[model samples]
Target: MKQIIKIIGNPKIFVYTLIWLMVLVVLGTLAQRDIGLYASQQKYFSANITWLGNIIPAPGGRITMVVILVNLTFMVLFKHNLWKIKKIGVLIMHIGGLLLLIGGGLTAIFSSEGNMVIEEGAQSNYVDDYHNMELAVINTSNEALDEYTVFDQPILGKGNILSHENLNFNIEIMSYLKNCEPLKRTAPAGIQYRGMLKNFMLSELKPEKENSRNRPGITYRITNSGSSIDGIYGIFFGQSVSQTAVINNQNYEFIIRKKRTYLPFAIELLDFKKVLHAGTGIAKSYSSEVNLIENGIPRRVLIEMNEPLRHKGYTFFQASFIEGLEGETTVLAAVKNYGRLFPYISSIIMSIGLLLHLLSSLPKLLRKIPGVSPS
Candidate 1:
């Protein structure tokens, strides 16, 4: 057993394992082989899933496992022998890289992202936009504190949603399709047919074919107090309104299509500034002045291309630019990641290791110098 332990704990074994990991990563990346299409001037794969598929299949190359294993091996091989060092900067940078990888893994597992678009003077209580899958809670009551109805169906197959006290009816997720345009369908008999739902709608009933309708919306019906209101709502990039229905004495409708439950708070863009290099029409940099209203207090924020504004366990990144009648607005995408601290820890470790490695080598080199004194 001692021999086996030695073999498993050998530094050479770690090196070999690292080499195999590199080989697999290279092969996995190469398996996507569409250089011609990748190099073309015109691009088409805009959706995240499509892009993911093009790079790595559903099984996802299995390279992540290799990465985890290699990192673990390195960590185990050098438990407490990482503090003796010389170059602090190099050590910090190396550790920073490892931290970044750990942060990335955490982001992949527990990060939530989405969008919320409001009219010039409108106010949104939820983040209606999305870059990935999320769980949303629709609050219907028009009070200071409204009751919420939660939906956590990541992929559409078979799901049942419980009705809340504020909502008139519960929701059932029959099917879900990504990318493809959904086909419209007629509602069943006895169930009043609502208007056609589009892009982002919740349906009271399932359509015939999952992807038949190119609509990325939902359609669901409910009867509150007695007045039955059934209609289809379409949610897209631009400004659009849902058909109003008076159910019971209170009106029950889906106003915004956003993922709200996971969010800690909200961010509103109050103003923006774009700077350009003089004498050359090229743009230099841009910044967005936003109002970060959290816990009932509003704070001014500035978010630039590379510089991000972080608050309340969420990081707001300067994702893109938008030019509109409001005198050029900047778009800042919000990201909420639970594993942000891991990067800091790993960065410290890697930095210390690198410094020790450098310092340990430097003394030997200096001693070997031809005329060097032992002072």
Candidate 2:
């Protein structure tokens, strides 16, 4: 046991381990699942934890495990004499590689992403739209209370109960779909009316037009008193509560669907400016001027595709453009994570490792020169 520890603890062995670690990380990244091809690095980790039976399934576990195993195996089996100055540079290279691995791991565990869409003249304090599905409750009576909020992840969909005491409700999400247009079902007409019906209520039949039916929300029933309310509606966007229940003389609203990923502040699209490369008409740069309202204060900001504006824990980027009466207007975003900094840090470390490894071999080449003294 001590011999194994001594081998790994050795500086020479450590450097070789880092070399293999770099190779493994590269291989792992390339060997990820097909879904990972277009997804960000953060998506890899979430996918890993989503599968059943294994901690990480086929490709994710295979790649990560191989990396760790190869790194350890190299440290144990290899013997490198790094006591000389030539070896010091090599050691620096390994240290940089270690930082890269650590940075990538941190990024995988802690990063999240979603989009924010804002229209002209519209002021919103919360995220206006999202691709993810969630369940939230709002008690208009108690404005101060958060009521109940539930997010449906892979694990949560597998039958985990979410409860809130303030509003006295328990929820279980049966299924959810986002960024999709689904085949809507029709409500039965045979049953007698049990509650108040409003004229502005949505049609019982699914709308025929798909273009106008862009956002698709979740449909989950509720356990009301004795008989279950099996057919409840949760419209697209946020707060899709179509039913009102009276509990202790107060009306409580139950929402089970998707909510728009929102920011603390409001972003209004003012105008968009586009510059194209001359002659060829290739795009050079595009930017948006936006009006941000936060805490009753409005500030004008500029956001470009790559050059996003970050304010109050949100990042605003120019996602899309609309040709309106004001020439053109762009979609200014409010992103949760400003820039993906962890991967950049990892890139820097990897670069340092490469530079040091190159420097370490220089002395050996110099010593090989004819008539050169050992000193």
Candidate 3:
């Protein structure tokens, strides 16, 4: 245990770790050109271990940061004489750094980020994840409301069978594609697929590194009592209507789409305005006027670039706008980070500590100067 502690506290080890982190940063930046920002981040920073070009193994951002945190903690607790008055500022600075590490860990585990896209005059109470997808089965027997059950993407694939208590039939996955396009039906006669999919075929496309640009497609069969009921149903993102299946005389709808997170309150898009640069098509700025409706009351709010709206622990920033058939659609970048303010708070603490340390050493520094005498 003593040897382990000494090794962890060694200055050489700490320096090497920092150098490795810098190398990772350089590699990650270069990788973004080929894999894009989101993929590079997942591969280099978010992962626990990463292989350089699928060969050499290296510690990832999370692992490197964790080791640094341990080294800092060991130095502060056992190596430094923190109780001494002269060392108080050094102790505080270490504490601030520790807080930053804690905040990063919290963000990695708990933060949620998604997007809310609302057309003009439309309201939404949910945000859709950019990369993750869900398989949703909705009960549409009632004309008033629909009950939905969603399954995360991890459990879906070819040959996987999923059954739910509320569902009268079991869903068996036939085929899954990360990126695909709908094609005109060209299969031979006596084919079994039904509904709109019968007229359109699913054509596989090259998957994009940016997951949001990829259209995922799934072909599934519904089986009841060991008998195939719905031949084969194809569903994909952006499908106007979900494929419907009738089992045991009950109406059910199935769809695969970006996962959604429901918000406590709904936001209604009142208006969206975009200003263009003079004599050019480039956008100068864009903003959204929204009505935040909560508990039967509505509050008007404006969200603009660099200015975000915060309510109920969620922050919504005006990210972009799209032109749709209905009009302009506003896309709000929604982020729910519990440790969002930790970095700012830690930075303030670190700055104060650094100033105090400088002040404490000023007298000693001045006395060492030639012709300078202590007061």
Which structure among the candidates has the greatest TM-score?
Answer: 3
Tens-place lDDT digits, model 2, residues 1-375? 867655555656446545644554554466354324323233333343223232533334334433554464444345355445556655545555555555555444543455554555555556543434455566666667645444544434524555666545455544444433323335543232222221122223442232224344444434443434423333433333355666555566655454455556677767668888988766678887778787878899888889888776566677766666745655554456423564576567667757777766666777999887545
- Predicted structure 2, TM vs. truth: 0.63
Estimate the TM-score of every prediction.
0.59, 0.63, 0.91
lDDT accuracy of residue 50 in candidate 2? 25
Question: Global lDDT for candidate 1?
Answer: 0.50
Worst 10 residues of 1 by lDDT: 39-48
Give candidates' CA RMSD values in order.
7.8, 7.1, 2.4
* Of 2 and 3, the candidate ranking higher by lDDT: 3
Which lDDT tens digits does candidate 3 get at residues 1-375?
878887887768778989999998999999988888888898889988999889988899999989998998888777746757897788889889988888998998799999999999999999998888999998899899998988888878899998888876778988889889988866652457776677887889987877679999888877773445657778888898778877666688888988999998999999999999999999999999999999989999999998999999899999999997769999999999988999999999899889888888888999999999867
lDDT (0-100) at residue 18 of candidate 2?
A: 51
Error of 3 at 332 (Å): 1.2
For candidate 2, what's the RMSD? 7.1
Question: Residues 286-352, candidate 1, lDDT per residue (tens digit)?
Answer: 7777777778887877878898988777677776676677556555566678877877787677767
At residue 90, what lDDT does model 3 achieve? 82
Name the lDDT value of residue 69 in candidate 3: 89
Worst 10 residues of 2 by lDDT: 192-201
